[model samples]
Target: MNRLDIIQALMGQKNLKNYLEIGVENGHIFFRIKSTFKIAVDPKFIFDATRRFGKSIINPYNLNNQYFEKTSDDFFAQDAQRVFSAKKLQLALIDGMHEYQFALRDVENVLDYMDDNGVIIMHDCNPQTAGAAGCFNDWEVGEWNGDVWRTIIHLRSQRPDLNVFVLDFDQGLGIITKNKPESTLLFSPEQIKELTYNELVQNREQWLNLKSADYFYNYFDLQRP
Candidate 1:
């Protein structure tokens, strides 16, 4: 199944009333979700925002569905709490800046607002090629996953309290949930940053610890209350 399939499956299992999406280009996956409240953030929205989701079925589900024309950093810094009036986020997709630090920051920001049983999905966690997962400044060059997988590694190693799962599909869709007894990082950024994708490939089990879609499906099914 594709990433959307995984999202839809999870959405079906829970009361994901409050939804937030980062990097909503053309509302491709953003508009597909039927949540009670929705907030999409993207600095450079390519399509026309006002006319895109106009009069759609999902629009009514979230009448207060806001479109923030700003980067995740800006949105978090200035408009995060504003968007989340009182309710903690039940679901959030971190498909924003794919870079390691940026993605890590996105995860950190979401943790502050996420509910105890909330799930955060991050895109591009499993890179097929070294080029895709490698660090690169130029976006015009290759299919750069921008070391987003490192964020997964960071989360797994640093915060053992959080249940982390990498769905081995669609370049790796990461599913994260919070638990108790939060701990400190076992490895440093300097140590993680030193490893190359090739090295990561050699040590995928240690870093990624990915699971199949079926595994995730079962986990979510059993997780429902």
Candidate 2:
């Protein structure tokens, strides 16, 4: 399933109405979610702030959405609690800065306000190539995954209370839940950062708890689209 499909499935299954999306550059995915309460955070939005990309602007669901043109850190520190005062977050997408530290902090910060049944979906957790996974400064252009996979490794290794895994599609969508983890990492956080992409290729299944598309379908008992 695509990102939207996975999200919508969870939305229906969990009865999730509150949503938060980090890195809503163009609102390609943000506006698509018909949530009751939603918040969009991004350092700078690329599209016209007043107009919808392709959807209707008059939909009342859109009116419930809030936008913050600030870094995820800034948003959390400055106004996160105030905006989310009435409702806890049920779903969140971490797609802001692709760097490991930023992505790591984004997940941690969101976890603080997540609802009991909440889930967090992290994008770009499996860079397909060295160029795709290169350190941020060395990136020239094109698709830059930028060491984000490291965050998955970090979470899996550091946060045993959270179940972590990756669906091996769409640059490897990382799934995080506060359920009991089936396994814990043997590697330390420092050793995890020292790991190379080649090593990841060899240990992807074990390290990322990689799953097939059917695994998700069966896990959630949701029919494939």
CA shift at 205, candidate 1, in angstroms?
3.1
Regions more than 4 Å wrong, model 2: 52-59
User: For all candidates, what are the clash counts?
Assistant: 1, 0
Candidate 2 residue pairs in clash (backbone atoms < 3 Å): none
Give the total clashing residue pairs for model 2: 0
Tens-place lDDT digits, model 1, residues 69-154? 99898998998987776888988988988989999999999988988889999999988887687666645566767789889888
Top model number, TM-score? 2
In Å, residue 29's CA in model 1 sits off its true spot by 0.2
Across 62-158, the per-residue lDDT of candidate 2 in tens digits comes to 7767889999999999999998888899999998999888999999999999987788999998888877886889888788988888888888888
lDDT of 2 at 221: 72
User: What's the distance in Å from true for residue 187, model 2?
Assistant: 2.0
Error of 2 at 140 (Å): 2.3
Which regions of candidate 1 are displaced past 4 Å? 53-59, 138-142, 180-185, 222-225
